[model samples]
Target chain A: MTTTDPSSTTPPPDRRPGGRTARTRAKVLDAVIAQLGEHGFDGLTTDTVAARAGVHRTTVYRRWGDVGGLLADVLDAAGDDDWIPPDTGSLEGDLCGLNEEIQTALTAQPPVMMALIASSFRSEPAADAQQRLWEDRYTRCGIIIDRAVKRGELPPGTNARQLLVTATAPVYHQLVLLRTPVDPELPSRAARTAALAASAGAFTEG
Target chain B: MTTTDPSSTTPPPDRRPGGRTARTRAKVLDAVIAQLGEHGFDGLTTDTVAARAGVHRTTVYRRWGDVGGLLADVLDAAGDDDWIPPDTGSLEGDLCGLNEEIQTALTAQPPVMMALIASSFRSEPAADAQQRLWEDRYTRCGIIIDRAVKRGELPPGTNARQLLVTATAPVYHQLVLLRTPVDPELPSRAARTAALAASAGAFTEG
Candidate 1:
């Protein structure tokens, strides 16, 4: 019998980079986020990233191995202060608050965040990084819906992750893909839709 | 004091050295789209695009002008198929059909398409091209929705453009930014949502 598996890993390409100074690495990581915001993934390059971070060229290569690795690390670091969905004990209030929080954050350099999400298509490191990035946000969202489910505010079989992704994804596309300015009122409306979707069993596993 | 527009024409960055060659342009465009599908926009280059197209290094630049221009042309040509929503006389059926058509066209090469969209941020030409690409699709969509409005299938106040964009944008993101696999069924769900949203006066103008 022939074995069939499309899943395969490719070896990482070595950049032969001289390696960055420790201080430069930290700065570069921050700069990666900012650059992602500024230039977007397509526009970002090692030269630009290095310049922005004030790091030596080789250091970015030796440390990150490539652009994908660098972005993955940045995503890992961006993990902070992004999660933490509120729980007002009511699913509606919790989601509304979370959407508001996201909307405010989106207002600042939205292109960068969008680019990061968009960048996940490149390969190994990017795919892994995006997965990690979404995992954190999804987990936080899951907790809120789980609470709702437990309290019977939502259906007993709600798939919180689906509800969360479906709800927020529209907001992301409206701003990022379409390049349309977000309506100020839409975030709360999204949350309301999310809450209703939850109550209406749109997320119910059954 | 001085009254003037920014410029009669945008920069000619899209122009390459020498002059444009139709054959070279078409080949280079193919290469760009092919590479974009495989390697994504973040890390690809004119050299690679040239190599893939079997053109001289100078030809890539001389013909397409630059990577951005190459990408813009490729995307424009891809969407030149001129898809229009069928006049099935039912808004729900029309949207669902269009949704499925887009899903079929997109999910197979979603990564490459997304990479192009993300890269558009860095190049004004690419951005302009993207807008043009969407306009064609949207125009056809408008025709369908507008007909529905005339038939009373949709509310008179419907924001057809927003309704159309919302219905379609998520499908793009599912395969691109969210990295979710797009199932054939999913498109119909999205279309149904849009149809229902429209019927509920979600598209109505205030």
Candidate 2:
């Protein structure tokens, strides 16, 4: 599988997976998300992560510099930009494409996602990165809507920006904010809902 | 001033607010929200909150039983059940009404709101309570859209639940997930947009 390129230009810990540094980073990052899911922003600490990961305290501190850096790395790793925009010649078909992407993501691992959200309040870098992630996601989203706007399937002056956001925001609330998992069917439903919403006049063009 | 009525057979702690016990409870609750805003779930501690609030650490431990319990109390304290149904006599009024309520609550204390979001991931009681909070908000939302469904402004077989959620999900995303604050006017604009979307046919009853 092709791996997501880390947005952080930080050199990979000069070691292969299963090697000492790789194993250590993996252990610590995993532990951080786990502890964050269990604890919260104010509850997370390097000590707890190290203990959970079974790594030496020095090793944890040395690699990431501090908890903030560690969290930044975790969020970076978590933001898998593997989504492929759907081109189904219709808004409904395109949304199904996007939902499938999110479903794949939610199924793979929620640890980093849980941590990024948990710590977003306290960490400025995390906040910035988190916003950037959305900007990227929405930028991708507009591509699908742009087609409808072009085809006159949607209103002439539809606010593609709001349409893009309105389309994806539900899956987010459903998966991360709400406790219940999004139904396997929810993605397709969401896509159609978004497409229909867009067609119904969800935006205002400048 | 007239106090909120407690005659509804609910627990005592919720009904009243004032003595040293009330003050202590409020401070501890405030501290947890503030600390969580500054800290994340895994970083929280009873010690820190007690120190921050100038209450005895033992008092905090005694009242809440633990950090989890403290989070519950904090969540409870944040609630205001003055749910007002929108009555502009149109679907547009209802949508704007729902949007305005959420914007007010979120901007009331941004840090606290962020802290609550982060904390819910770690604490089950916090998450459940938060879910109820969303339900409270959603229920009010449903009231608005149901009016529209009755008015025939929407298509027959409209799913008010899905429609209402799709309407405001972007507002939440703008503030919470995207970290971009919504403009004050955007709420009203969004409401209109959503109302139109509903009219033009965005959702179907499941």
Candidate 3:
């Protein structure tokens, strides 16, 4: 019997149709998310993650190095998911959609979000990753404000990031900081409040 | 040499005038705050705290039992501090004052605040303490909104909690979530936005 070479078992990075390298990355990342959801940041360990992913500990060590590296990959993969901000014509509708997205994330996977936020406070690498995550989210969500401005729903020069942050902050405060249940009406209320503020030009930077 | 009883060396709990009990408690609490500020929640431990406080390990063990109990006391003491919310005549002034207070806390002791927030996620007792802290802050801050309504600055029946949460969420998002440098203008801007929303009746529960 001819022995198969280990090198032949792995595909090049560009290979598209379910290559071994791609499969390994996917499995590792999926395990990261699952671990974050189940145990939070403090409970995450490379060995545990490797065991969960059914990968060798040395592979995890060589690939991710540590928890920070693993966390960055997890956040990067999450950021790469296909998500388009809503274009509902009206500023209120756009903001409501945005709020709904935040609410859904916080409600459905609180542990993962909490772990990410907590990581921002603990390590430099995690902070960099979290900052990048927020920057990416802000850039994507800014489209709502841009569309609203083009539609004459908001005045020109409105700070899109500020508006979105204002609209979303209370939802996070309720769910994370206050540890309170986010009522169904809270997101709509936040969106309406933000819309009112935006129309009044409260977000305009001088 | 006359022998003294070890039990008699300790003063009763209620005895004041800088008694040993009070001094020990003060040192322990101060050490807790210092540990939280320096090492964050993850690095804190009873043995370390007791050593830092120069108190007996048994004393810490018997008194606090765990980190959660120590955290509860720390929060309780912080809440008990003499701080009256600003009652500026207008909603803008009151909110601005409120914002400044939060900004000061976040800026002056970011690690302490971060540790407290992180602790809330890790333990049920800490979560309870955090919830109570927010509730107390909200009630105290509500007086500002109440006065605003009395002065006809906002619509009657406006949700005080909603307005305060809206006004402060951005500050927290800046300092904690986004990890952005909180510009001096951010708090006032947030106040204006919340004020605009309150005037538009966005905070009214319908």
Candidate 4:
């Protein structure tokens, strides 16, 4: 319907009610990821995504608005997944598990994760969406530190966000920033380092 | 001269042996940084850079080839600076100094450093040059760890690259990747965490 015009719509129904609308959104977003993975942000366009999603170009335009909107929605959809933090009994183990997942996502074939990160630099909408996703992830991972404090593996008053950032920053630095060859030991080593620092109350809040 | 044609030249003389050549290189590269800071990668162009540097378009095209080559040269020039790591007596202090420098570069008014990082994602040549620049900085900063070992602040055999990465990644991770607001304490806190972790032999090589 012409009522679906994004200019007139207040919220711009990305999650429109009804099975058909839901399916269209899912298909469009899925296509966005696939296109980003395969062609990168430079090659992505509403026309390409619409063709790949088997949807009308006008529909794609009305819904997503632009490439930035498409990229933002893809990241927003990612945060909707039920991604619970690992519970490996110890903080070190939990961090190691988390690091492994990060490593895998970063090194995935077609480099979708890295593409999204790169896209965020070019798109304001994607950057904002990514910030939300990161905040959501940080909040979710706070439980890892909570569990560790309960297990007496870490001291009370440890700042979970600080410790988590310390533990995970190395992977992103090494793999993404430096573009270094992957070191299999990096994940566990970084986790151990952060875990040790946390035990010493280095991340404890005032 | 026709001899300066990039196709005929095997080495592509970015640093030709003459005061004029040096001056031109300096002017152009400086212009590249200024343009990148002012307009970002999206707005950067060979024509705009040439105009900014007061150089002819033909000369800019002959030397730089394209935006990618221009970006690569800008990064390469950064590695030529005589940047010695801070010798702040203690490892934590040295790391704090290093982190503070990183924070400033990342949060500069025009955000030139961050723009270079964002450009690397879109340009293959820029990415390669950035990798080399990172390697050079890491190697140069190794002296900080060596002095720490000698001063008994950290254990012998502590991995300098690993320790430096641990100390510095948080700043980049927070400022660049997550786009978090600058926390003035982050530099020292991260440095202290990394120094403590190194004292515990977490980064010691096998």
Native contact recovery (fnat) for each candidate is 0.19, 0.57, 0.81, 0.91
lDDT of all predictions:
0.70, 0.72, 0.83, 0.92
RMSD of every candidate to native, in Å, equals: 11.0, 7.3, 5.3, 6.0
TM-score of each: 0.72, 0.73, 0.90, 0.92
Model 1 TM: 0.72
Instruction: Name the 10 consecutive residues with the lowest summed lDDT in model 1 chain B.
Output: B11-20
Across A1-206, the per-residue lDDT of candidate 2 in tens digits comes to 12335786655545645556767778898898887766656667888888999989888888877778778777776555486578889887887778777666654454445556656656777777667666777777777777887888888777767776666777777777765555787777667666666676656554
Which tens-of-lDDT digit does each residue in B1-206 have in candidate 2?
23555575644443255745777877888888778767656567999999999999999887787778888777666556475667889888777777887777666644667667767766788888787777666776676767777888888777666676766776777777786765787677667766666676656644
**Candidate 3 lDDT over residue span B87-152, tens digit each:** 878899889889888888888754687778767767678779878987898888888988898999
Worst 10 residues of 1 chain A by lDDT: A11-20
Pairs that collide in candidate 3 are none
**Each candidate's iRMS in angstroms?**
2.8, 2.2, 1.3, 0.6
Q: How would you encode candidate 4's per-residue C-alpha lDDT over B98-199 as one tens digit per residue? A: 999999999998999999999989899999999999899999999998998898888888889999999999999999899999999999999999999999
lDDT of 1 by residue, A138-168 (tens): 7867888878888888878777776676567
Error of 1 at B192 (Å): 2.8
Candidate whose lDDT is highest: 4
Estimate candidate 3's alpha-carbon lDDT, on a 0 to 1 scale.
0.83
Which structure among the candidates has the greatest TM-score? Answer: 4
